[model samples]
Target: MAASSAVEPTSFDPSKAYKEWEVNGKYFGDGREVALLDYIYNHPDIEQLRGNPEKILRAIDAFAQSVTGLINIGENKGVIVSDVIAQHKPEVVLELGGYIGFSAIMFGSAMKRAGGKQYYSVEKSPLFAAVATSLIDLAGLRDTVRVVVGTGAEGIQRLYDNGLLRSQIGMAFFDHHKPSYTADLKLCERLGLIGKGTVLVADNMILPGNPPYVEWVRASVEDKRAMDKAAQEKGNPNLQYNSRFVKSFEPSGMEDALEITECLGIEGA
Candidate 1:
């Protein structure tokens, strides 16, 4: 499949900038996440945020902007994924990362709005998962989004083995460990969870780009077959993908991209 680039120039609004998250050689996991819960619950308008997804999102954004920096898929990049959800209307959405439940609440609400069913958010850190669970429940998305704590591969396997992911996933979002992106995707393919109509949206493509994953998705079936011969983590080589690069900005106003890929079909099916 041919690669395409959709560029929409966006300038970060200085007024909306979040507090510098990086401090004294630390980015996250310095008790800030738990503090975020306290901040949200104690917000003067806390009642206004309850059961309101957008409002809760605003509250989270407020905390990030005024209190501390959060490693999240900010509203800017979030719109791109939401647009994809609106168009595709995936019934079951799988998110590889559920950091503090930002994307889970955002995308889970989007999925529900688009007539989708379940949204499974797999988070690696239990503490992060707990934080995400609370926020997601606050957004009134507990029924739509389910958080499973484990690494990408482990979570995928658990879901699949338990029949929660027995069929192909409608959409899968990758925002976990960068190195696990390709391997986890391969596992999905091998398990028959990535078939025609599957939409894969991978974040952090520009800040810390993933060349290997990009190359794998954009490769021709013939090229992929060649790659699988030597690859330890083998995916379905016959799967065809039309991948593209979408230029957007992070919530922090930093330039970033989401590699959006749509599986066309099996090559010989």
Candidate 2:
């Protein structure tokens, strides 16, 4: 007996761990986690606390966060736009794309706080507009915010025809289809709807990306640079323009998703 051969046993399993390293390795920002957790913690209790005004506002914020989380776990551009509008205390606000009333609720809340501000939201989807209208009513902001079912371009015409666009729009929010951003802004400009010192905010500049509009703005600014230089040479102050980028949390890193650019017309300039 040659010292009995050592026996060894090997363990085997039919199913192997198909580990997705990237999926499991992804990390969320603390801010994103907090926003998502708060949304989750509050959303389910919204209906139960609907009657209270403070709770309703919190619920609206949570609902907006929930909707945002469905696609991207981050702070919403609408909320940022609303905050800017509120800070400016604009008398009139025009919004393109009212989706499920999230932006509308944010805008309405800002308007309510600003006092005497009115919001006009144009949405191309009738179903979305209907939902927005219902939500507006539920939020008790029907009197402050109006949701119109139509593309902003068409809706602007209708509003003008209806005598609603005659007033100078102080702030405009562009959050609709990315391609339509520049066209809609031009349309409003051609109509002379935006007043001097008007603030125009464009969202989804990073993730969904609006390079065309961004490039156009850059080109326009570059072209203006020569004129500005000439103006400075002529003893006139160099023409000045500014844009502010608002950052949003991304799984990878912080990204700018919103561009809040103010257009200072001749009067304001």
TM-score of each: 0.98, 0.67
Q: Write the per-residue lDDT of candidate 1 for residues 1-269, one digit (tens) a residue.
A: 64767777577787877778797888889999999999998989988898999998889999899888999998888988999999999999999989899999999999999999999999999999999999999888999999999999999999999999988989999999999999999999999999999999999998899999999999999999999999999999899999989988877777899999999989889
Off by over 4 Å in 2: 1-79, 218-241, 250-256, 267-269
Residue-level lDDT tens digits of model 2 in 99-191: 656666676677668874688999897766775676567667888889988998898778878988885677888877778887777667656
Evaluated with TM-score, which candidate comes out highest? Answer: 1
Which pairs in model 2 have colliding backbones? none
What local lDDT score does residue 221 receive in model 2, on the 0 to 100 scale? 42
The candidate that achieves the highest lDDT relative to the unseen native structure: 1
Candidate 2 global CA lDDT score? 0.59
Model 1 poorest ten-residue lDDT run: 1-10
Model 2: ten consecutive residues of lowest lDDT: 1-10
Q: Give the C-alpha miss distance for residue 64 in model 1, angstroms.
A: 0.6
RMSD of each: 0.9, 17.0
